[model samples]
Target: MSSTFDVMVVGLGAAGSSALYHLSKTGKKVCGIDQFVPPHAQGSSHGQSRIIRQAYHEDPLYVPFIKRAYELWEEIEKESGKQLFLKTGGLMLGNSNAGVIKGAELSARTHDIPYTYLSNQEISTRFPAFKPDNDVVGVLEENAGILFPEDCIKTHLEVAALNGAEILKNVKVTTIHTHSDVVTVGTNQGKYLANKVIIATGPWISEFIPELNLPLTVERQVLYWFKTNEPSIRLDNLPIYIWEYAPGKMFYGFPDLGDGIKVAHHHAGEPTSPDTLNRNISPEEISSMKNVISTYFNLNVEFNYGTVCMYTNTPDERFIIDYHPQHKNMIIASPCSGHGFKFASVTGKLLSQLALDEKPELDISLFSISRFSK
Candidate 1:
């Protein structure tokens, strides 16, 4: 294998694949390395589905970036000849004053994104699968839906490879050294040199840049699919929904698509590490999730199966997509909390721009690493 390239992207998951694809389009000598084959179940992008919504509950600043992300997803779908996004609409359900509901409404209003406010009774009438409390309201947006994360990552890598980008899989990167004008990345397989490097290694990001002391925590999250025989719980009737059952706690779910209805908590997972994570789903965890489903939704609560994934989170739970503080040629772009998969399409483009010294189209100051120093 060649030992040099224009740019090297580490971590071939959501962001890394996308970055490689966009970088390849620049006609530069780009290469991507991954410890394991992508589109696999070991990382954050393997779940069958991930929600993509325009109403930014985390912050309204994300609205513009996600708007562009929607466009890019469509472009990739058209180019790759694969269905990437499913627009089933989405609902944010909680107390009217709750952060989830209020924050979603604020983003919609600030960005002029079309949305409908529904009362508890209205929600039950429109979507019979849901049974929110009298005080819980919903912010319904037509543009919200689900994205097949594994397919998206695979398609990105495929398209990049076809465009002449070399993708090295099952190759663990051992160390990275940045000189005055070049960066050297050492992998178990061999050493490769590049003009720049992008670190989007998800939970394993801190391992490569330990000096940053980034406030990143990897949380063990469990995703469950419950068997449902009800017709109302099917895709045609139930829109993807995020419910805030309590302050700072959330449960998001997708309608049945033959396999079953997929559900998981937004956060509130046990702290863990990538090297030593418990992949098993315990009965107590299953019962805990069933309790939430039975109380809020009108569907069968029988847990069919469960799987575990990791969420690399920062203190603010936003994202980290800035250059290394000391090494300008090295970019850090991982630990997206849990809400980043939806933005991977556009995030990749932004990272490519940063890697190539082009201006990013969106204001990403909120994701800067300097915030942690303050």
Candidate 2:
């Protein structure tokens, strides 16, 4: 029918929800729609917990954004009155020179963050659950911890709506056409038009931005929650841990949170589309991850459960946070390569600035879509 909203955000996940909140704060007419009710298990934002640390092991460029993200997360907590984050400290274990370990050390040094590098003997003495080899060491950033992922998304959406943003859940957008003045979006429910359009769809990004033909591969990852022998050894007592079994091959686990000791491999999975993501976790799959955890912790073997989730990865593993080259009014933000959760709050704020043609204070050149050009 007619048009509404100054901005129409396509997905209400980490990035989109932040955009909605910031835009609404500016008193702009804004609306956000998601394929499913966000904070639901259907998207990457689910799961009970996600890791949040300022010692970015990925790259030094990410340190600034991550630092800002930490601040924004606290701001969101104060505004929403939700205990969405916990600081139980975090451990990064790997070979002294390994990318994961060294990267974190470098970020900590570059940012002047408080961190300590411990040798294998030190690790065993301090954290008994770990058994790193002689050559392996760890960078312990005491501030790193966990974020209640689903609750974070919900808080952002709720605050956005409280500030006068419109949100529609369970309605999928089918098509989008942009003009010089406004953007028109067609969905299963109806049609919407707005002065600006942002497509933050996680796994479904390529479907809308076909021209980019982005090589985004969707892979299925399984999460297993193991029961601990002692309830005290669970989430409350133990800190969050990530270990690099080998370069680019890693396994991470969280403390027991009544659900069990959640463990999962990072970046090792078979390709699949979101619509066809395998929901069933095979017996062999559980065995494989269980074996990895057994090496570090004593598994009760009696109490644990597992579930499947999807990861949308780009070749370089960085995110695509740029807008359409032709349609500058449209922005795309699908950074679901696994580590996007902690940055969701800041990304939302930056994307909102981008929607209004304001440059984000942090450098997003690395995340630009043009980096994919030949």
Candidate 3:
């Protein structure tokens, strides 16, 4: 009483959905399953917008990956016949000695990526939306912009379905068991079998293979939207920006897309499981964020609302996107830490290749799970 396929993708969010979409083109019997209807608010992919930039501050190795991702996103955007990406440029703001600015510069210079180094006065002159301190400097990258998260996911799923991939929604996967030839996925409805399975489950991945004790930590992150009367805060005029206020402390914000300008502190939340995360934004949290905003920007922002998402992070913050060590038939990706949505387009293609026993065009040696052991 079950169906079978050549490949199965568990967790149809950023990575899984893309993988399913790519695999569907291989003429293989591929299928994807999700706990809830995707483009839903239950996971990490649902903020109205996510920043996509080329100046890789986290690591320069990510630059090439993002370069390929940009091309793929444009290709999909064209096929979907909808506006999925907005070219708003991007800014990295911090003092001369700040890690955020220095790292971004290092990446830009190393990769020959086009970027401009700006003084605080230059930043104020170019973008009137912010109040940069005298010593604060900036890195301006032209191609960096915003991606509509919900639209991107929906487009991938829609295109994949039209290409003959089966999508199962509202079905919770209870267990995943892999043997010699087939990987069995047991869901609330029934068991499904596949030759190989890509575990792109995002935050809830640990629930599948708890015995591995993978070093992944699920951090509860909040994205806040604020309304400002400042006319210059519109998306067309303002670029997405990351503000490194102190040595390593930072927060990022988006240009107002009519709804409001969005802001959130980077890596500044408590560790929590996906199921037990507190969903509401408290007054205390809002006040703390307001204090940060008031210190960094000149405009008065009224807090609109906050939404919660989880980051499945590794110890070093790099992603784990390789085959399961013990099980060759299983491929696993812990995620690209907190900054992976932009890479979803290219990552999906890589995952599809891995599932089909082909070499990925991009070198993913750095994201191997084995790195965690040493």
Predict model 2's lDDT versus the native.
0.84
In terms of lDDT, which candidate is strongest?
Answer: 1
Query: Considering lDDT, which of the candidate structures 1 and 2 is the better prediction for this target?
Result: 1
Task: Quote the positional error of residue 192 for candidate 1 in Å.
Answer: 0.6
Over 1-374, each residue of candidate 2 has an lDDT whose tens digit, in order, gives 65577888999887788878878888898999998888788767777999999888888888888899999999989998999899988888888878889899889999998998888888877766665677878888899999998888888899999998989999999999999988989999889888899999888788998887887998888888877576445555567878887887788878877787788889788999888888998888888777776676644454378778878999888887888988998999987798888888888888888998888878898899888885
Worst lDDT window (10 residues) for model 1?
A: 297-306
The positional error of residue 286 in candidate 3, measured at the CA in angstroms, is 1.1
> Per-residue lDDT of 1-374 in model 3, one digit per residue for the tens?
45679899999998998898889888999899999999889988888999999989988999999999999998888887978899999999998988878889999999999999998899988888788989999999999999999988898999999999999999999999999998999999999999999999999999987877898888889899888889878977789999999878889989998778899988888999988998888899998888888887778989998899888888888887888888978999766578889999999999999999999999999898778788
For model 3, what is the error of residue 27's alpha carbon versus the real structure, in angstroms, after optimal superposition? 1.3
Sum up the clashes in candidate 3. 0
For each predicted model, how many residue pairs clash, with residues at least 3 apart or on different chains? Answer: 0, 3, 0
Clashing pairs in 2: 234-256, 235-255, 235-256
Q: Listing every candidate in turn, what is its Cα RMSD in Å to the true structure after a full C-alpha superposition?
A: 1.0, 1.4, 1.0
TM of each candidate vs. truth:
0.98, 0.97, 0.98
**C-alpha lDDT score of every prediction, in listed order:** 0.92, 0.84, 0.89
